[model samples]
Each structure stands twice: as structure tokens, then as C-alpha cells.
Target: MNAYGINPDPSEITEITPAVDGVESIPLPLYGYNVSAGFPSPADDFIEEYLDLNQLLVKHREATFFVRVSGCSMTGAGIYSGDILIVDRSLDPAHGKIVIAVVSGELTVKRLVMRNGRAILRSENPNYPDIPAGDELRVWGVVTSVIHKV
Candidate 1:
């Protein structure tokens, strides 16, 4: 069993290195007014300031990385198959926090749970079971934010 508490399915996971090559920080104009999703409101033409996503999303540049999710195991936690997750290695993997972990060399994303003083990686979906994190489990990073297009 892997981090999902079931036999590891090779097709259900994929690991990709964060794309930082030739990527430069660009500051975009941030508006002051908050857009309403419930109904359309009059446009407020106010420029707050220049906002850089790198500075906002990433806390520690060296310890932070991005991962593309590839499975529905974390759907219950609002993470979809194509979501981009911002993971920070410097943060502590506390209980109930979603994390990207490598179990026996296999990479998987799940919530960290404590059971009987032992760490167990649990899936957000009820279809999956909780996998006991033994000595071989290595936490890659803690998920700080998830981004997906509406």
C-alpha cells in the first residue's frame, strides 16, 4: 500500500519539476475593489498597487515548489486532478494539513493525520483508505495553496 492506503496505482500519479526556467517576476496591477461573484456590480476604477504573484504565493523561494495534481483522491479537499499546488518544504506537516509525500520512492498527495501517535497519510475521498506512514515515508512538502481555473 502506498500513501493512499491502497495498492499503488502507477497510472494515477505523476511527478513534475516546478517550471522556473527563464521565468521572470512580473508585477501586475491589482485593483482595489473586490469583484462580486454573486451579481455584477459597478466597476470601481481604482488601482491598488503592483502585485507580484511570486512574492505573494511563495514564502521561501528556495524551499517552495509547485506540483501538478493528477488524481481525484484529494477532491474532497477541493483539489482536482488538474490543480496546481504550491508546496512549501519549510512549513511543518501538521495534522489535517494537506501534503505532498514520497512513500518508498513513490510520490503522492494526501492529508496528514495522526493515529495512535503514528502518522498516517489519508485521502480526502472516502473510497480510499489511510496509509500508515512508517520510516520510509518522506514528506516532500506541505501544501500552502491550490490554484485551478474556473
Candidate 2:
């Protein structure tokens, strides 16, 4: 199981297809994340209250994929370099879905916006520019969830 509550076994996912063009394959982190070896001190209740043993387990029938993030363009959205993004292709892609897209031969992760017959990829940070998607743009998958460290 992953941090975003997904099982990574191939047999578990009902949706499977061949890889698309220009899509760099990324590995999903199926196991849980661990930063240190020892248990957290009693003073910190975040782990105890939220991540108890009972909650750490997951059923194997759910659909989930993991993709490692690159670049800081999504920093404003809380997704940093090396963070694992949980992508649920089973979910429908709607407006405002943080999607992994292939635009003009590049892989980009951004918020999906559609208006006036144009699909725009909006960045969470103002420093980055918005990208317009035409017929050549491909919406790879919708990012259902994100997993990152504090």
C-alpha cells in the first residue's frame, strides 16, 4: 500500500494499457514511507493519532499508481521534487483535476482548466506561466492524490 491509500499490484488494477508515446515510465512506491528507524517520541501525537497500526493496513483490490515528481514548478501546490504523486486513473478527469499531461512533447503536471474551446494548464505558482493545450495535448492521467514529507 502507498501513502495515498493505494495498492500497487498489477493484478489489483482493472485498468491497464500499453505506454503512450513520449511518456517516461515512472515507478510507484508501493511500500510505506519511513524516514527514521526508531519510533517517534511520545510528545509527537501526529503519528499516533493519525497513523495507528489499524489505519496503516489496506485492502488489495483498490486502484492506485505512483509517480515521482520532478522540478519545482508545482511548489505552490505543495508538490516538490522527489515527492510521490498518487494517480488514480479510475477517477474521471474533471475541471481542476491536478493532472499529469503530455503537452507538445513534454511531460507536465498541472491543474486542468477548460474554457472557450481551449484547454489551459495552470500552474499553482504565479512565477510559472500557464500553458494552452490544443489538439496535440494529451491528458495522461488525473492526479487523484499527492504524497509528500513534511
Candidate 3:
């Protein structure tokens, strides 16, 4: 969880797909004050905490895997191609949550929605059609965080 609840522009996340990897414990000095985008303010010398990005981003280390987005289907939600997604297999996939599911022998990231006892993989982009996830639906994990680079 974010220590100060200060949400970034996109989000904080990581993991390399294909080969399962582990995040190193790299604690960086975290200043308490929020960096202003406009006028500059007096800097605070005190370091509030040492933030370990890996710990803050990954909840379940063993169950989490990073998958890089391959398309623009979820661009409306701030997810874009080449962005790494932190997925937790331990988390239960619920409605209105982004998830990675195998649809027709292919992996696609979409929002999960339940409609009248049926599951639907809703794409964030209007160009993509909503996929009905039925027998072939095998959810790999739920997206916990998104790592988009500037």
C-alpha cells in the first residue's frame, strides 16, 4: 500500500513477464513533501521514510507476475502498450476489476464484469468489442498496479 496515499500520474508497479522474477529490496529516501509542478517551495531536509518500491507494489510476492501490455484495449484506463502490469494470482477476480484472462488460447487484459450470471471481458477502448468469457475463460490473475513510464 502507498504510505502517504499519494497517487502518481499513472501508478506504481512492476514485473517482467515470460520469466518469473523477484523485485529487489531497494529502499530509497522518500521526502514527506509533495513535489510541486508549478511554483517551487522550501525543501524539507528530513527524510520521512525509506520506501521500498518492491514491497509497496507487490502484495503477494510468490503469486504475483509482471505482464507487459501488448495493445491499446485498456488505454482509457491509463494502461498502454509496453507498460508493465503487476498481477496477483492470490487475489480473487471481482467485478469492475482489471484482469488477465486467457481467451481463445490468447492472453488479453480487460476489465471483468458480471452481467446476469454471465462474465464479460470489457475493453476500455471503444474500438475493441466486449468478449464474452465463458468456457474458455481462465483468469491468470487480477491487476494490482500499473507501471507506466514517462
Ranking by lDDT: 1, 3, 2
Candidate 2 on 13-112: residue-level lDDT in tens?
Answer: 1233332334443433232335487744444333323342212321111444567776677778887777776665556767888887766555568889
- State TM-scores per candidate: 0.83, 0.58, 0.81
Model 2 residue runs over 4 Å out of place are: 1-63
| Per-prediction tally of clashes | 0, 0, 0
Over the stretch 1-150, how does candidate 3's per-residue lDDT look in tens digits? Answer: 112232211221223453245545789877777766753343556567889888888877779888877767788989998898888999999999999887655577889999998888787888766777667668888999998999
Better of 2 and 3 by lDDT: 3
Predictions ranked by TM-score, top down?
A: 1, 3, 2
How does each model score on lDDT?
Answer: 0.79, 0.59, 0.74
Q: Clashing residue pairs, candidate 2?
A: none
Model 3, runs deviating above 4 Å: 1-23, 38-46
RMSD of 1: 3.0
Cα shift from native, residue 9, model 2 (Å): 31
lDDT of 1 by residue, 55-146 (tens): 88988777888888887888899988878889998999999999888887877899999887889888888877777877878788898998
- Number of the predicted model whose TM-score against the real structure is largest: 1
Q: Report residue 130 deviation for candidate 1 (angstroms).
A: 0.8
